[model samples]
Target: MNRLLCLLIGLLCISCTSVAQKEKYKKEKVYTVSKTNAEWKEILTSEQYYILRQAGTERPYSSPLNKIYKSGTFHCAACDSPLYESKYKFDSGTGWPSFDRAVEDAVDKDVDYKLGYARSELLCATCGGHLGHVFNDGPRETTGMRHCINGDALVFKHKESKNE
Candidate 1:
């Protein structure tokens, strides 16, 4: 009877450890744009600092970028790294700027459990700033991934046509 109890306790410990590990955020080796907190604060607005530096979420449908469908490249507001091209942008109706994909190698994903649930948190590879979360329920015709990015974390550059 004692042997069976010991085995059960050991199994329980292993499972608990795995769960704890899964909830921890994994850090990347190096970010291209590193800055002090003071420096970042000087450059970013209050809302941008909250969303990017503190990992806070913006209110739904509050961003003007939500309605912009113009052709352009969206770059990280903090570091100016190109994140998503307009070609991959989509209206997911979730009230944030949704994209099917990000530019190749422009972002890194980390496991986040800030809200008591595991989520894929997108970060700027250049500055390690938090962008938002990525979900699986996107357009079936494309990657089927909805990168629900925070607009305060991005700056759009309108691509001018040659017709000018």
Candidate 2:
């Protein structure tokens, strides 16, 4: 039927548009810790490679860092650059480890339209590793922003006690 044919055509157009929008931000950049693809593969695990290099996201509420509440710092897994402080972290209940802010000059944000909408995409300023997204919802008493990050992209270091 002509009705069925027209409906199919309309669906196809929508699919094509969505695909095009997703790839709009796929261009590569020169990172501070630039390495050959093979070199990066050797240095990082398979999951880290997928998220940091390919801009993939980890499963929500799946990061051990989400439950971490110790006094310490979180560094980029790729380059070991300090990115966040323990004081800024909070439970946003959005799965990932959410922070109210990053350390000064530690992260660089860019407009990401991968999901067909604009979002603040956070990256490691030192290595350009994709951390996650930042949003406006956060502690009103503090920064009023949430830096939702992937635990796979970070390595947490607990502060040493003076008594020890």
Candidate 3:
């Protein structure tokens, strides 16, 4: 009766408030390397454009960068900003390249709700390109953060030999 209707209304208000708070955390950021969509498409391949500019995810295990264990820095494909180091990369077996941590100040994070739930979305700090998501379920020994990133968003630059 009246009590039931009041309870339902209260619950609805609570849910709406929570959703608003979550949305507030994902404020849009101005990046150092902003470019028009056409400019981005010109420099990026179709896959890169999709993942970086449009916030699309590449199919897991599709990137050749997954198996690479060489010493190198993973750079953002859009702006060539250094992100994760190879030394921190690990086989999370989730298909995409996983890193325990990112280079300091190299990336930014925001909450994403594309999957009907909140996920910590990682982005290149320089270009604001979507890299992937970060999770707390990572190696407990180190930072305990898994920066699960899309390979199409990164370019690997192998460390140069000192002899060269």
Best-performing candidate as measured by lDDT:
3
Q: Which ten residues in a row have the lowest lDDT in candidate 2?
A: 22-31
State the displacement of the C-alpha of residue 2, model 2, in Å, after optimal TM-score superposition: 25
Per-residue C-alpha lDDT of model 2 across residues 1-164, encoded as one tens digit per residue: 99999999999999999978877876766777888889889999998988887888999988899999888999999999999999899999899999999999999988888998999999999889899999998999999999999999999999977865
lDDT of candidate 1 at residue 4, scale 0 to 100:
100
Residue pairs in collision within model 1: none
Error of 3 at 146 (Å): 1.1
Q: Top model by TM-score, which number?
A: 3
Q: What are the per-residue Cα lDDT tens digits for candidate 1 across 38-68? A: 9999999999999999999999999999888
Candidate 3 per-residue C-alpha lDDT over 3-26 given as tens digits, one digit per residue, 9 for 90 to 100: 999999999999999978977895
Backbone atom clashes (below 3 Å) for every candidate: 0, 1, 0
Error of 1 at 88 (Å): 1.0
User: Model 1, residue 39: what's the lDDT?
Assistant: 95
Off by over 4 Å in 2: 1-29
Q: Which regions in candidate 1 have their CA more than 4 angstroms from the true location?
A: 1-28
Report the poorest 10 consecutive residues by lDDT, candidate 3: 19-28
Model 1 scores a TM of: 0.87
| C-alpha TM-score for every candidate | 0.87, 0.81, 0.88
Better of 2 and 3 by TM-score: 3
Winner by TM-score between candidate 3 and candidate 1: 3
lDDT of 1 at 90: 92
